[model samples]
Target: MYDLGDIVEMKKAHPCGVNRWEITRMGADIKIKCTGCGHVVMMPRREFNKKLKKVLESKADQA
Candidate 1:
């Protein structure tokens, strides 16, 4: 499972050739920032779920 501030990998690489993203906001829509290019993207929770591959790092774990 992913939560705010978690680093995650997506099923497909981004156009920037990076698959890792950082969760920035969460709600009905989730906002993610590209780790490679620093580009931000917002998508519906359902869509995010479908594209999400795995959680790389969790905020809770860091705390």
Candidate 2:
């Protein structure tokens, strides 16, 4: 499962030309930051799950 501060790769590219995002918040809604444009977005968990490709980095990875 994904949690806050996790870096994930999406199946699709963003307008900023990035496929990676950093998870900033979690719960029923998830907030993520674009690695390319630094834009932030908040979406429901179901949407996030649909867009998610893979987990690149997790909280444990930081430690």
The candidate scoring highest on lDDT is 1
lDDT of 2 by residue, 1-63 (tens): 777888899888899898889999888999999999999999999998998999998888788
- The RMSD of every model to the true structure, in order and in angstroms, is 0.6, 1.0
The TM-score between candidate 1 and the true structure equals 0.95
lDDT minimum window of 10 residues, candidate 2? 1-10
Clashes of each: 0, 0
Mark the regions of model 1 whose C-alpha exceeds 4 Å error after superposition. Answer: none
| Tens digit per residue, CA lDDT, model 1, 15-62 | 999999999999999999999999999999999999999999998998
lDDT at 56, model 1: 93
C-alpha lDDT of candidate 1 relative to the true structure: 0.96
Give the distance in Å from residue 38's predicted Cα in candidate 1 to where it truly belongs. 0.6
lDDT of 2 at 49: 96
**RMSD (CA, angstroms), candidate 1:** 0.6
- TM-score to true structure, per model: 0.95, 0.89
